[model samples]
Target: MHQNPSMADIKVIIPAFNEGDSITKVIEEVPDFVSEIIVVNNNSTDDTFEKAKKAGATVLTETRKGYGHACLCGLHYIDKRSKTPDIVVFIDGDYSDYPEDMEKVVAPILNENIDFVVGARKKELREPGAMTPQQVFGNWLATFLMRLFFAAKYTDLGPFRAIKYKKLKELQMEDKTYGWTVEMQLKALRKKLTYKEVPVRYKKRIGVSKVSGTVKGTIFAGVKILGWIFKYSIR
Candidate 1:
């Protein structure tokens, strides 16, 4: 890895699953201020790895095929590296997030020395019909319960978030399925980590979504996320 003298250092970790169509574009859209980009290919059936490599992102393959599994594999790679990162930014590979605003997401942690940052999305920011009714209701119900249980404030369980690498590791993130984002948020609150929210834009993705697409998928994902939130919030 090359060093930047300008002092703007960050590592972007993208977990991709069958996102070959837009992964390359997303990689290209990421701000160059980021020192490193690690893309974890979560058992993609397409050419996600090839496209990411073509876009100059360091790529690794995670055969287990879950969002949390892919992220954990990437984190393990980072942990094993000689030079660790100052911050770790987790973004989806589907290009729903505005890659340019990555600076905004990482700035609070970088400047104020905050421990973690979540990219919150307002209703207007979301693509029309981007979130299913179940998703919206699930977020509200889960977040309400979280606040009630742990007295912690949370706006969105967005996947587009960043955290200090050290503090992130200390949380011992263990979610291996669809509940990854919520698990991180609940654990961070329980651990009393300094976290902030930055409003971000969301767009329609290039391909189909695994969750929020089918009735079963939506219910299962919402149940898993809510279950994880309650499990940690009570602890």
Candidate 2:
């Protein structure tokens, strides 16, 4: 049904908010072989859009603020009225994820025909204090529950991930909050989609984090993520 030959033909979707400083760097690192790059500027107070546009990235704005909401906007753009790449790679605008590794993540999906892929950042590779104690425990509990209830296996719920566009659309993704990553993994598990994980180096992101810095943010994220996983299991 699609003519694109390999994952290189995929589009890179980066969700950014107030990342004016590092957006250009991430975009520049993306291999030239990529078909299209869309940066969803989620109501950035700074000149995020201008900088991304100048870097030759197709910039779109989502007034509402939320990681999942911004990505939903990007997906709508890609699904409804765009080139419709064979695969879609989601990367954060913070430049924490190595852009050069995009090829590494997508290769499994293209060559071996994996349905979706996640860039698993092992605990050993994660930087000191990169994950709060609460974060680490929450991830373990959540992944355990996912394996127990959904029978899914994933090490880290990292934002750096890739999936076939067709499978992505099949998921009918609806999370508009911090739980988006977990939600996607649960769906992939429930659907029994072929999945793979690759070793991706993790580093501190530019600027302060949005969800992990505050007590309220951390607790709310933990609650939302756990709630989504179980809620789907009952359905």
Candidate 3:
């Protein structure tokens, strides 16, 4: 069994876009084992950058206004560091996920040598009205399609996930928008990486969701996610 992660080189990357109201709480709740908390401000028109920095996290700016872009910017920042972390955890700054549960999310990777882990947001564990109807349907359709096409076993494309840094590098992720989460899962399947899903609690976010809250955002996200699935299915 993994004794403890306190000595492990673990880092967290949170992608924030106008999550000023929740970013600080998200940062503060992270487990102590995390060596560094990197919050990528995705061109937030609010005080996301200031709040994240004030919370004692390493803040980076990605003016591209995309989830993937912000995550990529965080990865680039880590790449420049002299010492690379052993594990990288990706979480959203919206505070929907319980940051304290990160240890459970990373346990499989640390103990069983799992290459990737997804924090499955089971319906029983989610707060009421935490996920929009579009979000729920989108997750079901996307995971079902992935299973049908790739024989994968994923329940949700939850943003709360952990992966070995080296395996993550091997994925060569390129999505710059809403397709980021699905792209990572698809790539993991293609690479035949050992993976697992751990149940995690989800709650309502502090601010409006940028993707699932608006009509255009919902449609665009649906298209992007489906587009990635089909594109990978054909390959």
Per-residue lDDT tens digits for candidate 1, residues 65-174, read 77899999999999998899888899999888899888888878767878999998778889997767777888788878877887767878888999989899989988
Judge candidate 2 at residue 60 and give its lDDT: 91
Give the candidates in order of TM-score, highest first. 3, 1, 2
Arrange candidates, best lDDT first: 3, 2, 1
Per-residue lDDT tens digits for candidate 3, residues 1-235, read 7748886899999999999999999999999999999999999999989989999999999999899999999999998999999999999999999999999999998899899999999999999999999999999999999999999999999999999999999999999999999999999999999999999999999988989999999999999999999999999
| Cα misplacement distance, residue 66 of candidate 1 (Å) | 0.7
lDDT of 2: 0.86
How many clashes in each candidate? 0, 0, 0
Displacement of the residue 9 alpha carbon in candidate 1, Å: 3.1
TM-score of every candidate: 0.94, 0.93, 0.99
lDDT of 3 at 197: 99
Better of 1 and 3 by lDDT: 3
The global C-alpha lDDT for each of the candidates, from Candidate 1 onward, is 0.86, 0.86, 0.95
